[model samples]
Target: MSSVWAKKVNSSKSGFILSTRASLSRASIVGGALGFPRIRLPTKYLGMPLYKGPKKSFLWDDLTSRIAARMEGGEAKVLSPGGRITILKSILTSMPLYLLHVIVPPKSVMCRIERLFNKFLWSAKGQRRIHWECWEDLCYPVEEGVLGMRRLQDLVNAARMEGGGGS
Candidate 1:
């Protein structure tokens, strides 16, 4: 069965890796017979890391760096609250939505992102000012007398629910 599948797929051209527990090292035997190179565990597939076990903070380091890079700038300081909100909703939040839909990030990562948002919204430089309301209150619907900012966890929940996770 495996031989037949291997014969059907030209693995070298396809960039497919044969991942197995057995230590099959000889390329002449494994590659010729299986038509693929042996790969180590935790290979990346379609930009997301593919590995065994629960999601970890290291997996999200690149994404967090990207979010932090976007949040840092003189432009963020200059923008009004509404403009900052626009960037948060349209640019910053959307950056991680694709990953969030697939895996739930750790609490520390979420907190870091939230802190970046809060700082951009309230502070201009090293100086800090009192936030008029907590982040949760600010994330409420506009009709509730707050900015209609969607929380990252809430967005992940919604995505999970839509993907049939909710009963």
Candidate 2:
């Protein structure tokens, strides 16, 4: 029967060809995607936190104990410049991005990750401010670089591969 033969053909295809292909193209399938969360601190600067204790300063110590607790716990999500751009792109692509931008600043685990990579992985100075760059910079190429941070688009693709797409 055609149905039986068709099922056999479908089963014979490699999972990556059958499954991975869709995931790779998920961003294209989904109209919008959720990005990493931004912080909720009431501040004007895009990356720095607001210091509201005695005088307005960016000093971490000036914040109240409650706020300090958040900081010590690394409450501020550190995004790499590349990740920041992805968040920005997400904002540009959909209503949620605008809403998230208006509601909060971007946050991530990237602050420390970027710092460590720049310092140890690149064997660079650990004392300087790290300029923001794209996430791809942190990733090893399919060939050369070490495996680190997930590529946003790749993640989007993976989601698609997993059949997580929507209209």
Candidate 3:
């Protein structure tokens, strides 16, 4: 967040801040004089939403939407089951890891994310395949159950545990 302000506010090339000492008109003048746009809060920085107040479920929708977009693409349909599993375990899961540590996404957002992953994992050639087993069964170790990918709920619990553990 500071990095954005550093470039826009501190540098002579641009400017920022809707400050107390200075009104919006003054800030606009400064930015206009420097030829830069004014930045507002609740903006995205490094792919995660930056905002004040509660971490609402809707805020995490971008993470789900991105996954949904990936799943909706033509390329995902060509991958084999094993290939899909590998992508799920690697790319899909990793995308939300950083944000999970920062905010505990509400149940709806997590469900949407899991639903997208499950759909991607089971679908074949753009056709929806019937799921033979519960999603949880596929996520555990082979000996205990099955092995595929970790659930978003597990990741959330982990993030909560990690955040609470620092004290």
Candidate 4:
């Protein structure tokens, strides 16, 4: 395979090495003439992290931290409820939309995001307030006496369904 690829490249580069997560035997290593480099199990490719199996908490650590950092920027605290909602809809939710399109975030992660939005909506200091309505009711259309705030889980589920193509 390497020989075929080398033929295609036809380059005189001497430092060519094979980097893979596969386990190769000693004889195969000698036959391939490829140098193996130690690599971590999961690595980033094209900005998306690559792993061997299902998504896990560790895989989401960077994304979670990014969301936390954004929330901690103090922008949410200064805005009024309406302005906070606007920012939530336009900036905060959109931050993770691309990732949601690719992977269904865990419930805990979604809950943390929702908590941040909830705090911004109800209180200026990020504290919990007396609820006038349930989250489901709050997410309803404005005509229905609600704020029309789209739920993150619903969006994630919709994206998953869309990607699955009616299956």
Candidate 5:
């Protein structure tokens, strides 16, 4: 029965020879991408082919290495609070939220605008925005008619604390 089946397949006018080669090529192309290099089965073995040897997994290894390298480059750098404050001010002034809306209207942009407005309250220019109210007043909780901005004075005091208070 096996001999008859093989004879029928090989003797077909449909050109099984070309089709088999095409199938092998397609399988190899897909298997190579999946890190399984193609291996030629011995003609004597009708079934149950063995895994010949190590199929170089360089494609998979190289892709993973590139992703790891990129993550390392984007690591955040530490900066002084004062430096952060200056950078925030520059971003706000250079590209106000309203102006940014024309270029890239996004929810994050609106959030940033809100944050900058809050920062203005902590800035030296904050005093000029309103009279008879210190920067702390504007930062007070909504119940106090302020937006609950964190107190810069407290942060400064904490920074100057002896032995980094409350370790």
Candidate 6:
């Protein structure tokens, strides 16, 4: 009999209601009853965008920024080429795969991301370097003696084909 009942809904905290159609203002429902603030659209949930509008390139800008932020410290001088390839294949490239699975990014956006990966693979911090090998060649199967780095464009095409859309 020593337990206390903490049954307050904490009217100070804000809440969000994600609805596909803004026909009804449910914000008022909770605002009046619970004193919670109403959230606006174009917000994110668990780091993924939550808008239902047309799929535009700008919609995914946050994704590329996140990728770059993760690989910000150019490891060219710290890790060997093999290490970089392993990290890129296992981590950096895989970061967007989850989002890619749900949303097919525009080819132009994919190209920009691919270029960022290429530059990181070949260049050092604050300096440019030649891509001794093009990305397509690098993406060759590992059995063919090259590192198997899948290109971003190839991923978009694969997703499209998988979803019944032609190349």
Q: Against the hidden reference, what TM-scores do the models get?
A: 0.73, 0.22, 0.69, 0.65, 0.20, 0.69
Q: Evaluate all candidate structures by whole-model CA lDDT and list the values in order.
A: 0.72, 0.35, 0.75, 0.65, 0.36, 0.73
Worst 10 residues of 6 by lDDT: 158-167
RMSD of every prediction: 6.4, 20.6, 6.6, 7.2, 23.0, 4.5
- Writing each residue's lDDT as its tens digit, candidate 5 over 36-152 gives 444453211222222223422331233233333332232202333354344434533333323222222233333333444444434342132333454345445668765444433
Alpha-carbon runs more than 4 Å astray in model 2: 1-128, 141-143, 162-167
Candidate 4: Cα lDDT at 139: 74
lDDT of 1: 0.72
Better candidate number, 2 or 6, judged by lDDT: 6
For residues 1-167, write the lDDT of model 3, one tens digit per residue.
Answer: 35554433545443354544567788778877877766665667667776666767766777888878877788787999998988888998898999887766677787778777888888899999987776666777767857657877778778777442211
> Between 1 and 2, whose lDDT is larger?
1
Error (Å) of candidate 4 at residue 66 is: 1.8
Candidate 2 C-alpha lDDT tens digits along 8-52: 333232121122334535633341333222223344344345433
- How does model 6 fare in lDDT? 0.73
What lDDT tens digits, residue by residue, belong to model 4 across residues 1-167? 35544444323322222346444664366435644333354765444566666655576677767766776677666777778778777887788788788767667777777776665567666666775665555777889877888887778778867542111
Worst 10 residues of 2 by lDDT: 11-20
Tell how far residue 31 is off in model 3, in angstroms. 8.9
Q: Over 4 Å off in model 6, which ranges?
A: 1-27, 30-36, 74-76, 153-167
Residue-pair clashes per candidate, as listed?
0, 13, 0, 0, 0, 0
Q: Write the per-residue lDDT of candidate 1 for residues 3-48, one digit (tens) a residue.
A: 5444466675444354465455554476676666656556665656
Tally clashing residue pairs in candidate 3: 0
Q: What ranges in model 5 sit over 4 Å off?
A: 1-76, 96-109, 112-167
> Which of candidates 1 and 6 is the stronger one according to lDDT?
6
Q: How close is candidate 2 to the true structure, as a TM-score?
A: 0.22
Task: Say which candidate scores most in TM-score.
Answer: 1
